[model samples]
Target: MSDSGPSTPPSPDEKPAKVQFNDNFAGKLILPTEEEIQNDPYRRRASSRRVSRRMSKALAIADILEQERQYVIGDIIDLDTIVEADDIEEATTRTRRFSSVVAASRKSQASTKDWRELEEAGDESSGEDEDYLIEWEGPEDPKNPYNWSKLYRFFCLFTVSMQGFCVAFYSSSYTAGIPGMMAEFGITNRTITVLGVSAYLFGMGVAPLILAPLSEMYGRRIVYIIGMASFTIFIIPACVAKNIQTIIIIRFLGAVSGSVGISNAPGTIADIYQSADERSKAFAVFAITAMNGPPLGTIIGGVLFRYLGWRSINYFSLIAAGIFFVAGFFVAETYGPHILREKARHRRLTTGDDKYFSRFDFPPATSLATLLRRNFKRPLKMLFTEAICLAWALYLSVIYALLYMSFIAYPVVFMGLRGWEPQIAGLGFVGILIGTSAGVATDPLSRWGVRRHKVDPETGKIPPEALIWFACVGAVLASIGLWIFAWTCDPGIVKPWVFCILAGIPYGLGTTVVFTNGWNYLLSSYSIYAASAMAGNAISRSFLGGILPLFAPKMYSNLSPAIASTILATLATALMPIPFIFYFWGKHFRERSPMLLALAAQSGI
Candidate 1:
């Protein structure tokens, strides 16, 4: 043998010779022949070592690819092919290329996942480091206002509604103190004193054109707090005012600040409740509180003015503002974009990442001036351009004007004709309160109608027109109530109790249904633009509220109470067709308008 001369053991690094089996040896192992071992002793060892190294390298690459898949794809990986693969280099190359393709596909698809995975994959492909965006962790994320616990949501609703009630209460409550104000100031003209009310209502209408957009930009919480705080603080000047002009000016400013809650409350409710069905009930409660506030405030002001003083009304307002101010602290931010922006800011601060942002984050239309200009003009544009908005605005404005005129009408009927004191006359509002309560109680029926009308038999989706049914029924009821009130206003024709109890109840009931349903319909029809639509409603109502009362004294004096009342009733009867028209033809009108089409698309209608 070649090595026989040495007859030495193999070095430690060298492999031992292998045993081999004969082709047809019948389960017998055959040692390698001496000639074969001498020919290639280390060949099997070298080949085995090379195969082991190659497999280890392939497994390592598979592990890296699997890790990349997890980071990129955000789901479990399938590893059967890599595990079963036989050719190491081929599997490694194929897997590496395939994983890269899968990653690219995932990036391009951008499936809905948490922000973390999207950020990582985005960074990897671009080969540039980027900060992560902040978003809801998932659809059920509790931080989302829509996903908040029921108790918390109700608390928020209650707080905001209370704010609205306080502001609205302030709007008409002080009318009770007007007589005392005239006596104290020694002024003769009632029109001059009524200017206080007119100015306040005008302020309420105009301020929302600006404030609603600010709420959208900043947040509901900040706007509410600042507005309530200013409203509360301004009550002092009005209470101590020595001159009519001073009181009127202070009241206007207070009204301006207080109007913020009115414009923003619907938006907050929309933010909290995404479904029309869910929102209907919340809006019913909201409508009840808002509808009841003026009458309730009149009741409170009558009692306070009789017992305490004229100034006590302002004091009561201050107390209400304080309560809402403290409660405002607990109110969470409800605007979706504002909430997301805040989340983005928190993420950037914590991660020390500059690229973190929200989809809502943008350059904001070049400048603050442009942003404000667009926002300020939006409500006007919606008011004038959209038929749905115009019809609803006209209907609401007329109804609201009639409602304010009732302030004068009630006094004329109860105090002037029936020779009752101011406090007793204020009791006529009890019928309205009863009607509002009835409306609140009947809201479930409206919701049922909405469900029945809106739900697709197959898809279970609600159409926007579903909201108009209640409005239609409300128009009929409101018309009947107006006619009853008009024909029955005379004490000679019917007892005061008859109109007060019978007529006022239906009037209140019909008014509540119309307002609540109309508001809900507008909200549904213009989902993202609901705030601007509401602002339009507010402007029309407030404008009518201010202007209508000025003519109340003349209308009742010039035309007999019966004729004046009939005029209002006739107008109401004429407009009764509005809701019905909208119910049948609203969709066609919406289709015709590009603004409505865009809104419908945004709402996925």
Candidate 2:
């Protein structure tokens, strides 16, 4: 070989020679022999192309390795082994292994895959010596709520549910005090006194539109703390208020603060239970507590008002709110994104590295205002645009309206017709409590029904619409109960116990089933946006619950209790078809909805 360095550019007419290397040759620069240079034009072109491609690949691999170093700290790279490789083939082989490891690590970072996928992937790679991403640290990470001890999870669930129960208890408990409030404030119009309760429900509806998103931005703990504390504090003023306006305004504010528990509790349940079956049980308990609170409040309030006085109702709520506030401290943060974000922050601080971040960490570039605007608009947008949300909201709203109207209807029958005192009349609500309990007890049946209709036979995962089966049954019962109660409420027709047991129990069962199933369907269908969907449900239900009672007295008086209630029963009967329609065709509706389609794709349904 000659050591000459200069080579002239080829003319347009001349073809470049190809270059060839020995099988054992390393990637060392070499001068060409005069004979080889003169004869090998095509080989020269091929050699140049090979060198360019290798250089590009090396640069790309270096970039990937650097990124891995920044985000992951471990035996992920072996620089010494690569540097010691004696030939291009050896180096290329090692680089391919590194690339494969990096690709596997990136795949593990993905959050959309279900637990089965993760387990299967683990089995497939059992023999490989690799450093996969540590998303949940082998599924036993204490930080992951899904891995929490059952006792601890139950405690958390109970605490959160209690918070919801307190708010709901206070919502209707005030109704029993309305007489005292009217007399004290010298309010002649019953409508004005009723506004005190309506104002609170309206606040409950509107506040969730803001607070639910705030809980997502901040953690659930902070929201619960602030909300419960404010609620407790506000009760003091309402208890001593001289005017009805003060009571109404303060009650509204208190309800707004307390709304956080109602809005975020379902999301907390989602965090703890990864499977729909487990979540259904939790939701059943939550639904039962929520449904029973109003009736329980009615009972408590009537007793307190009759014996201790009306202001004692506020004192009772104050005590409950205080207990919830203290309990809030022990309730762990169950929001997954919030937990991951905190983990990322801790890791970054401990490692002194900014790149150790969780996938859920919000972008630093995003502004608070932008986050608020997006989150605030999401629930309303879902309510109006998503077919599933719109239909379910309407269904839940009507059911909730009927439930509130029962407070009015019961008094009409037992007090106005039977001439029962307030305390005895309040006992009528026990039928609702019994029915709600019965509905909760049947959740296992609903779960079995869902499994029977599994969308994926292999995985046994059911569609969201599977929940509507309970709703369908509940609707029929509700319609029948309404008609029965309307007709049997007459004084001479049958005993009072007949209406209480036959009509109230079935109505209670039906309403609880509808509420529970509706919530489950919404939560499952919109998992990522569960809170937003819940906010929509709250808005519709509270709005109708508040407005429906305003007309109850007028309705009973103008049309007579039988005709008035029958009209409601007819409407309830008309709505009976809604759950059935959704049960059969909901999937089609979801397929057409862009939002539902995107959510389904994310959840791998």
Worst 10 residues of 2 by lDDT: 74-83
Clashes of each: 0, 13
Candidate 1 Cα RMSD (Å): 22.5
Score candidate 2 by TM-score against the native: 0.73
Candidate 2 segments exceeding 4 Å error: 1-139, 146-149, 273-278, 347-353, 454-463, 492-497, 524-531, 597-605
* Candidate 2 local lDDT, residue 588: 74
List model 2 lDDT by residue over 339-399, tens digit each.
Answer: 7678767875787744454434433333457545755687789889988888888878888
lDDT of 1 by residue, 73-147 (tens): 111011110111122222223322222222233224422222234334444354432225456888998889989
Question: For model 2, how big is the CA root-mean-square deviation?
Answer: 17.4
TM-score of each: 0.73, 0.73
